[model samples]
Target: MTGPRFTALAQSLPATVPFVGPEAQERAAHRPFAARLGANENGFGPSPKAIAAMAAAAGEAWKYGDPENHDLRAALAAEHGCRPENIIVGEGIDGLLGYLVRLTVEPGDRVVTSEGAYPTFNFHVAGYGGTLVKVPYRGDHEDPEALLAKAAEVAPKLLYIANPDNPMGSHHPGAAMAEMVARVPEGTLLILDEAYVELAPAGTAAPVDPDDPRVIRMRTFSKAHGLAGARVGYAIGAAPLIAAFDKVRNHFGMSRISQAGALAALGDKTWAAYMHRLVAASRDSLAEIARANGLTALPSATNFVAIDCGADGAFARRVLTELTAAGIFVRMPGVAPLDRCIRVSCGPEAELAAFAAALPGALARARQG
Candidate 1:
């Protein structure tokens, strides 16, 4: 019997998984990590309120989640001072990214992003047969001007920028981001991914009219909110831009319990503030850990710090391998200069202690070989 044939685009694509998850790694290693700090997930865990809400709603999991996502959207709209029409909730920012790429990209269409920015976005763009035009980072930060220039040059269908960017954890001021937004070409759409916004310092997130049609800003409960496993995220944009998501998005994609949990999480601002403090403290502690090991941790506004291993990508990879072998789970950037650094996420004392204990040995082992 003959096997099924893939579409032309699928046949043309390489079989690549953008991220190798921790579960897969554990399966291969035959052991659990002593410290799991990679992937920028908030290790402090979710609020008591959110946990309680989810537990209460778990019994009703047999029913499909609300297709409209009405209750959660309304609560989110009220929190952000926008109409429900301005919001589109999804499984997570990753899923929302896929939907956005599908909505705007045609086969061979152009998309622009930072060279070493979020790989998930790039993966989705590639899946849709969009040509990715990448701009290298300037000074370890996503250069807004360069990105804008490339967008204009390519007249890309979509441009992706992650404020408080991942892997590096650097960010531009809100005013600077607004300036870039103003300069975006008329036909292009900007995807401002603010997954780490809750951890950013004040004024780091640019102020924009939530109704702005030129860009859609995505926020997730994954990072600062400690709800990564819930897979809840939302996009804010002009009503029309947000409404378009409904045309192709999986209406019943959101888990009902996740909605309840996220709503409770949003309402408990005090708990959010507490986690913010914990993250800030963990960041400092991780920085100190890096410094103690003679490594330099880059200044960060997110839950992760990019520590310079004072060498090239190969050396950094060696350090990462040793660390992982020592049961410390962390990640590094994928591109050249940035890849010289290893990224570590902020977590509770116990996890940080494990990383701290493992670092010197990891460095020593890497240096020996």
Candidate 2:
């Protein structure tokens, strides 16, 4: 019997998972983690109103979701002061990123991104056979000037940057981002991932003309709204670019329950504020824990902190391993200099205490090794 034929790109790619989930780790270890802080998930959870909405929509789960995402889009547009045509909602930022890469990249097309930025975007680029030209991070932040220089040199189809960057939790001011936007070379589209913007300080989001074709900004309910599992994300850009998603997107991809939950979550301003306060407090606590343990917690505007381990990537890896062995789940960066620290997500006091209790032993054992 003959097998199904595979495309050249499919054959060329290696099987990989960009991030190994906490659940998979639990199964392998044959025990549940005492603290879940590795995945950057909001332990506070979705708004109560969102929970109610999802419960209300559960019976309607059999029905297919609206392909147009009309109500959600309208609500989002109202919130952003833009028309519905300027927004497109999808399964999540990851899915939207794939669609964007598919829309713009052809085989051998050039793409520019930081060396240790979001790896999933790089995964998508590889899947589509795009050639990625990566620049190193400037300190803990993505270097806007260096990225623009590379984009100008190669005229890449896509330039990717994550504000309040992940794995490091550093951010640039919105004005700086606006300046970067102005300098984007002609013929290149910028992919601005703002998944953490809701948790960041005021004025952290750049001002972009809704009709400007130079950039498309991706936002999600995953971080601040505590809807990570619900998987609802949206992109804002020029109407034409937004409309182009209709050409290749999954018409009914978003879950009906997820849509209901996200829509409700978006409207709960009080809940969002409470979460912001909770995350800020927990972040401070994490920093204090790091300080007590003789580590330096990087200043962060997001819901997580990167605690420098006072050594190289190997030592940080050992610390992480010891922490995981002690049942405190945490993660670190995958590349050097950046990887010299471990990333911990903000959570409730109980979970933070668990992390605090375990960190000292983890560090001591790592030091002994």
Candidate 3:
């Protein structure tokens, strides 16, 4: 007898994933990494209050989380100066992106994104059989003008951009972003993934009208708030678009403990400054580490730096392999010329030191080969 038939979409899809977690690497290597710098996770970790809040919620996990995401959305609404109806919380931006693609994209629909932007967004678009039209990065940044031009021509179902973009850590100013918002083509929705915006400097987040239906901006507790494991992220958009997610989202998908943790983390305003300082210090630390090794680290507005290895993608690959062999888990870009650099995350002093020690050897070995 034949097994259950797979849908054509499922049958045609490849099995590869966007990211391989460090734990998977640890298992393959048979040893834990001396430093985990890949995946852009916050090595500094969650707020103390969030941890305590999660601990307190552990006993109540038998009950399901609030389906409406009431408390977390209220907190996020206040933080963004919008009403609760303006926000929708989900299991991080990744989950929200999936729901978004399902809500808007369909087979053969055009989706526009910058080449070498966040891969996961592309992954979601692909999963829905949407056609992706990628615009090349103008220099190292996502060129908003090029993206909007492409959108105007393609009139895509969605346009995806990550501020303080991943893999490169470059960001456009708020004014530039606002200008892009003003030019979105009719019937196109701009999905601004601000996963790292909280880690960016002042004026980084574009001040778009929350009631504007053409844009949907998302932020995650996963980054600066250090709640990646808690999987909390919220989107801000027009009320009608925000309500559209209700038809597609997993009503009880968010964990009860994660909700409590995220709410507590949101209330702890002091941690933002502390984490900001830690990230700034660590960025400098990575920069010095790169300079000492005779490399240059790109300017970054987020909690990571992309170090130019001063060679081709092959040389960068060797450097990454050597670093992993040395038990320092780091990642590089998947495509060039971005692949000519390896991305490093901001970590505490100890983890950063481990990377620093391992890097020179990795560089030397990469040079020899």
Candidate 4:
């Protein structure tokens, strides 16, 4: 053969990038975006302590991060009232999801997730040749009862649900989340993606015991901690399942500086609380901007707002195009119905001001088209 043959599954897959990031767009346009609000990145940035710690750790960059992530995992466990055995630190929730998928999913295995939930998670599912059964969102929220019903029927290996969900910014109260966790089908491990939980209102986290084997929770410093660039995340579950990550994860994937930064970020509790306030304030400002523009802003418990464009997906897309063209970067949902809204991430006032300035002209252009 002229070239080495790939696996049948790899050959069958499409060569597609699920997300075309803002940087790619900027490169095409030959200019930077006025407001980088598309990717749900925390514009507030990492805590001062984290930044300082990263700088301090830079001298030690020659050494690899701990394969075991010893001190960091221990701190996380203490924070969550769990033992160190229950946590596994990784590159990010995205990387951890890949490891989890590879560990549990074989060819032809089934997994369940909401239709338009986190695309990265879906990407991992597809990579492993797992059959994904998508449950539609009911009233802009992932339907717990429907997802559980399908899981019970199909008995899939894993089920995913994200609270304070991405793209839509809707959230279920802690009581509902607890109920969903309780209803997970027998033999199914629920993957609760709580990446944005820190920014959510009080009582958003479910009251599940840390040692619960039925569920594994993934969290990150990527959101309210403002450490998106650092790429640190962890999973909490029963000791046995947490231990299983060692079988597939890139043991030394985490950077030494990133580990130090994450540890410092955790130690700076006041910084986390301050970020919560800033994000909440930015959310309100975004909502106000939407309202002023004659759009409906959905309620949010996350660091972003999804503004309903008061029209169909076509109109919303036109508006998004105009916004992007006007030097403001924003993103909309990929699928229909949900695509009738555009998602805007929380940022400092200067960035939001740019967004606010561009929106009206963008709307005018969209209307003309």
Candidate 5:
């Protein structure tokens, strides 16, 4: 029998994934991690109301989810002061990114993004045969000027920036982002990943008009609302651009339980505030732990902190290895300079305490090596 034919692009791609979950590590080691602090998940968890809603929705599992995502889109539009036509709710930001890439990128189309930023976006771009032009970050931040310059040079079909950036936990001010938006080249469509904005300080979200065709802002319940597993996310853009998603997206991909949970979560402002405070405290705790270890914890506006390992990428990797060995799950950046730090997700005091206890031993062993 003959094997099914694979496309040239599929054959050319490497057999690799962006991340390895902590569960995989636990299974490999035959032991569970003492603390789960990687993956940038909101360990503070979803709202109680959301939990109840999901429980209630469990009984309706037989029915397919609303393909249009009407109610959720309407709620999101009201929150953003835009019409429902301006929003597109999808499985999550990751899934929405894939759809966006499929719609805009033909084979060999150019795309621009920060080097060592979110790998998932790069994965989607590559899957669709887009050529990526990556620019290195300036210090710990994604340089808007650098990205803009490259776009002007390459005239890429897609451009991506993540505010309150991952792995480094650095952010550009909303005004700075607004300035960047104004300078986006004529044809390039900007993808602003705002997964962590709900946890960031006020004035951190760019004041972009929802009807602006040049950019699309992506938000997720995965971070602030602690609904990562639920896989609910939405995008805001001009009505026409938003409508384009209908062509390529998975219509019934969203789950009924997830939709109900997200709806309940959105209405729970009190729970959202509580998670914000909890995450802030957790960030402070992580900073203190890093300080005690003679490391520097970079200022963060998201639900994680990047603790510089006082050396190069190798040293940070050693530290991460030691932590994992000690059952404290954590992650680090994959590239140079930026990889000099380990990323830890914010969690309750108990989990953070486990991390604090393991850190000194991890540091000592890493230094010895």
Candidate 6:
């Protein structure tokens, strides 16, 4: 039998996997991590209500989830004080990003983002053959002005910004974000990824008219909601832009059980509040741990912390490798300056204690090597 012919795009693209998960690392290490902190997942788990909802929905897995995500959109609309037409739910921010790129980017279309921002977003842009234009962070924070200038210069179709940014854990106020949005060129669409927004301090999220045509804000249930496995996320924008998602998105991509779980998670405000407190406490504990080792922890508004290793990227890389070998899975930034720090997720006492216990040995070994 003849093999199927590949599209030119598929044939031209390199075979690459974006992330090697902790389970893969464990397989290579021949042991499970004592503390899982690499991926910024909320170790606090989901609300009891959400778990119960999923359990109840499990029996109904034979049925398909609502293609339009009507009920979930309705609940979200009420919660956010926006009409349901302004929302488009997808598998997660990652999936939404792919759709957004597909909608806006033809091959060679320019997309602007910070040099070391979320790799998943970059991955999507690459998958669609979008040309990436990266601006460097201005002292640990994504430089809004620099991004805007680049957008103006390149006239890129999409501009990606993650407020309460990943890797560095720095953020800008909502007013600043609003100002940045106002300055975006008419044809350029701003993709404000707020995956960690719910975990940020007050005023960190910019306020924008839901009907604004220049921007689309994407959010997820993965971080503070502890529903990473649910693969539920939504994008908020003008009705027209939101409606455009239907043109190409997988109508029934969401699982029935995940939809039920996400709906429950949204309604459980108490659990969300509790998770916020736990995150704050964990941040403080992680800061203390870093100080004890003579490293400085960057201030974080998300469910993780990035600790400056008081050294270069090589030293940080050594520390990260040693940490993994010590059964503490953690990650680091991908580029220079920022790459001098390691990122660790916030978790419960047991997990934090394990990280703390293992740090000194890891550091010593890294130093000796």
Relative to the true structure, candidate 3 reaches a TM of 0.99
Clashes of each: 1, 0, 0, 0, 0, 1
TM-score of every model?
0.99, 0.99, 0.99, 0.98, 0.99, 0.99
Give each model's whole-structure lDDT. 0.92, 0.95, 0.92, 0.92, 0.94, 0.94
Worst 10 residues of 2 by lDDT: 172-181
Q: Write the per-residue lDDT of candidate 5 for residues 1-369, one digit (tens) a residue.
A: 999899999998889998999999999889999999999998889999999999999999999989998899889989999999999999899999999999999789999999999999999999999999999999999889999999999999999999978878999898888888899999999999999999999999999998989999999999999999999999999999999999989999999999999999999999999998999999999999999999999999999999999999999999999999999899999898899999999998888999999999999999998
Candidate 2: stretches off by over 4 Å: none
In model 4, residue pairs whose N, Cα or C atoms come closer than 3 Å (at least 3 residues apart or on different chains), thus clashing, are none
Candidate 1, residue 32: how far the Cα is off, in Å: 0.5
What range of 10 consecutive residues in model 5 has the weakest lDDT sum? 172-181
Q: Model 2, range 1-369, lDDT digits (tens) per residue?
A: 999899999999989978999999899999999999998899999999999999999999999999999999999999999999999999899999999999999899999999889989999999999999999999999999999999999999999999979989999898888888899999999999999998999989988887889999999999999999999999999999999999999999989999999999999999999999999998999999999999999999899999999999999999999999999999999999899999999998889999999999999999999
Model 1: lDDT equals 0.92
| Alpha-carbon runs more than 4 Å astray in model 5 | none
The lowest-lDDT stretch of 10 consecutive residues in candidate 6 is 9-18
Candidate 6: stretches off by over 4 Å: none
Q: Which stretches of candidate 1 lie over 4 Å from their true place?
A: none
Error of 6 at 201 (Å): 0.7
The total of clashing pairs for model 1 equals 1
